[model samples]
Target: MVVGLTGGIGSGKTTVAKLFKNFDTVAVYIADIEAKKLMNSSNVIRTKLIKEFGKETYQDNQLNRPYLANVVFNDKEKLHVLNSIVHPEVRKHFQEFVQLHIKKAYIIYESAILFESNSQQQFNFVISVYVDLEERIKRILERDNSTKQEVLNRINNQWKEDKKLLLSNYVINNYSLQETSNSVENIHNILTQKACSIL
Candidate 1:
């Protein structure tokens, strides 16, 4: 089974994904991490990004993330173009990763933009991690060393949490680590049972 896990900025989706890793039968594929790798390693992506945003997109053969982030977050059209170039590659990589974990009970594809990109249809189930906006802003500010306005700009780019919850098969409130872990454990058990029955 393919499950898509998603949440807004600072919603602790990555932490919940790590908790899911504790389950032996579950495999997790993180789209953002893989996308970063592709951006740095894939010549096609490197060329396209540089062409779109200019040579500063990379420096010393590494992705100049701050520059790219500044360009994209400031312009919705630029961010959309960037996603248009990158998401297809990420989806292809995700498919290959899923194939490698074919025998696992289920694999989770964790993406921040799963719903925004309309990629939720690729999953057998969709899970959205939620956190209150103030807490989310606090977390992002600390973790990213970003200003409140900058963090809010990123948050504004994403679909609202309530909209995501409406589309999700399961919703995990991730204010506390213990509570998030418990929710992941419950979901893991349910997915494993469902996958086993299907087999």
Candidate 2:
């Protein structure tokens, strides 16, 4: 089974995903990591990005993430264009990753914009990780060393918790490590039982 995990910016989705790591399921981080790899390795991606956003998008043979972020986050059209380039590559990578892990009982593909990209339809189940907005903002500020408004801008770009919650099979409220870990363990147990029943 494939599970698509998602949450808003600063919502502790990474923390929740880490908790699931102990289950030995394949976890794919669809945005930051995979997208960076695609940008660095794929000449097609590089050329398209330059054509769409201009040559200033790269530096020293690497994507200038901050520069592109500044441009895309402020311009909705440019952000969509960026996502258009990255999501297809990520999805292809994810399909191959899943094929290699077919023996595993479950695999998780985690993306910040799963819903926005309409990729949830591709998964057997969906988990939405959430944290209080104030806590999320605080974590983002500390983790990213970003200004308050900058953090808020990123948050504003993501789907609200309530909206994602409505569409998810599971909602994991991640406040403390113990709470999040326990939630993952419980979900793992539920998945195992369901899989066993199917067998």
Candidate 3:
């Protein structure tokens, strides 16, 4: 089974994913991390990104993430184009990863754009992490060294919090670290049991 764990920028989904890693029965795939790697390592992605965004797309053969983010986050169409170039390769890689981890009770595919990119169907269960807007903004500002407007522009590109919660099979409220950790444990137990059941 694959569980799609997703949330908007700065919603602490990565923290929840790390908590899930404590369980022997669970394996986690972080899509954004892999996508970044692929963008740098895969020739196809590199070629397309350069074709679309020019030589500035890479510096010394590594993806210039900040330059790309600046271009796409402020332009919705450009962001879609960027995702189009990257997401499919990530999806293909994920399927191969799933085959390798077939024995695990379940896998968590944590993606920032799982819903926005129409990827929820690939998972048997989907979990949405929720943190208040201000908290999310603060977290992003602290960690990303980005301006409020830049962060807000990225946030605006995604589906709203309520929409994600409504579409998700499960929701993790991630305001407090202790409480969120407890929630991850509980959800992990539930998912493991479900994955193990004969029915």
Candidate 4:
């Protein structure tokens, strides 16, 4: 079974994913890890990014994220162009990962833009993690080392929890790590039971 976990910036989806890692499940973080690999490994992607954003977008053959961030984060069209380049590459990588993990009873792919990009349709289940907006902003400030305005700008780009919740098979409101673990376990239990029934 393929499950998806997603949330807007600073919603603790990664924390829930880490909890799932402790289980006998294979979990893939598409946005953070896979995106990094695709940017580094694919010369085509690297060239396109450089052409779109210029040579300063890379340093030592690596993505100069801060330079790119300043470009895309402020310009919606630039960010969309970057996503257009990166998302397809990441999706291909995800498909390959899922194929290789077919033996696993359950597998998870986490992406922040799962719903926004209409990617959740590929998963058997979608889990949306959320937190109070105020709390989420606070967490983003600390985590990303960004000012309030910067964090808010990023948050503004994402779909709100209310919308995501309507589509998600499961919704987790992240308040604390312990609570988040409990929520994941609840979903895990349900998934396990469903898998058993299918057998």
Candidate 5:
């Protein structure tokens, strides 16, 4: 079973994914990390990105992440173009990862833009991780070398936390680590049972 896990920037989505991995039966496929790998390693993606964004899209045969981030973070159209080039490859790679973990009870497909990409229907279950706006901004500012406005710009690009929470099968209010860990453990048990029943 494929379980979709998503949260806004600075909502600790990656941290939650790591906690899920603590369970022996859970496997996770992090789309953003894989997309970066594809952007750098895939000739097809590299060619398309360079053609669309110009030569500075890559430097020294590696993705110029800062340059591209500066470009797309402010422009919706360019961001759409970048996602178009990378998402298909990430989905394809995720399929292979899913097959590799077929023996596991369920696998978590972690994407920061799960709802924005309109891919939630592809999963058997969907989980949304959430924190308030101020908390998210504070977290992002501390974690990334980003200005508050830049963090806000990125947050503006995603669906609001409330909307994602309403659409999700499970919601994790991640205000504290111990609470978040408990939520994960509980949900992991639920998913295991749910998957077994489906079989």
Candidate 6:
């Protein structure tokens, strides 16, 4: 079974994913991290990105993240182009990772834009982590050292929490770590049962 786990910036999705990792039957695949690896290592991705964003897209054979961010972060069309190049490869990598973990009860694919990319349909279940906008902004500012406007801009690009909640099979209000862990534990048990029945 594949579970799509998603949340907006600073919604504690990563922390919840880590909590899920504590369960023996579950495997976790972080899409953003894998996409970064693909962007840096995949020859096809390198060629395509260089063609679109020029040589500055990479420097010394390494991804120039700041340059890429400057190019895409503020431009919706450019961001879409970048995602077009990266998401397909990430999906392929995700399928391979799932196949390798076939013995596991289920796998969680953690992505910040699962719903935005219309990829939630690929999963057996979708989980959304929710936090208040003020809290989310504060968290992002602290974690990313980003300006308020910058963080807001990124947040604006994502689907609203209310809309995501309407689509998610499960919702975790992640204001507190202990509470979040408890939610993860409950969901983990539910997914394990579902996985057993499916298998």
Pull out the clashing pairs in model 1.
none
lDDT of 4: 0.84
**lDDT of candidate 6 over 116-170, digit per residue (tens):** 8999899999999999999999999889968998898889888999999999999
Would you give me the overall lDDT of model 1?
Answer: 0.92
TM-score for each predicted model, relative to the true structure: 0.98, 0.95, 0.97, 0.94, 0.99, 0.98
Residues 17-112, model 1: lDDT tens digits:
999888888899999999999999998898899899999999999999999999999899999999999988888888899889999999999999
Candidates sorted on TM-score, descending: 5, 6, 1, 3, 2, 4
Tell me the tens digit of each residue's lDDT in model 2 across 1-199: 8888999888888778777776774454555678789888998889999999898999998899889999988877888999999878877877888888887778878888999999899988899998889998998888986899998888888888899999999999988788888888998888767666766
In model 4, the clashing pairs are none
Q: For each candidate, what is the lDDT?
A: 0.92, 0.84, 0.92, 0.84, 0.94, 0.93
Clashes of each: 0, 0, 0, 0, 0, 0
Off by over 4 Å in 4: none
Candidate 3, residues 44-114, lDDT tens digits: the string is: 99999999999998998789988998899888899999999999999999999999999999999999999
Error of 3 at 93 (Å): 0.7
Q: List the residue pairs that clash in candidate 6.
A: none
Model 2, position 141, has a per-residue lDDT of 89
Alpha carbon deviation, residue 193, candidate 1 (Å):
1.1
Write one digit per residue (lDDT tens) for candidate 4, span 1-199: 8888999888888888888888875555557678988898998899899899999989998899889888887888888899999999888887788788777667888888888788888888999998889999888888777889888778887888899999999999889788888988999989877666766
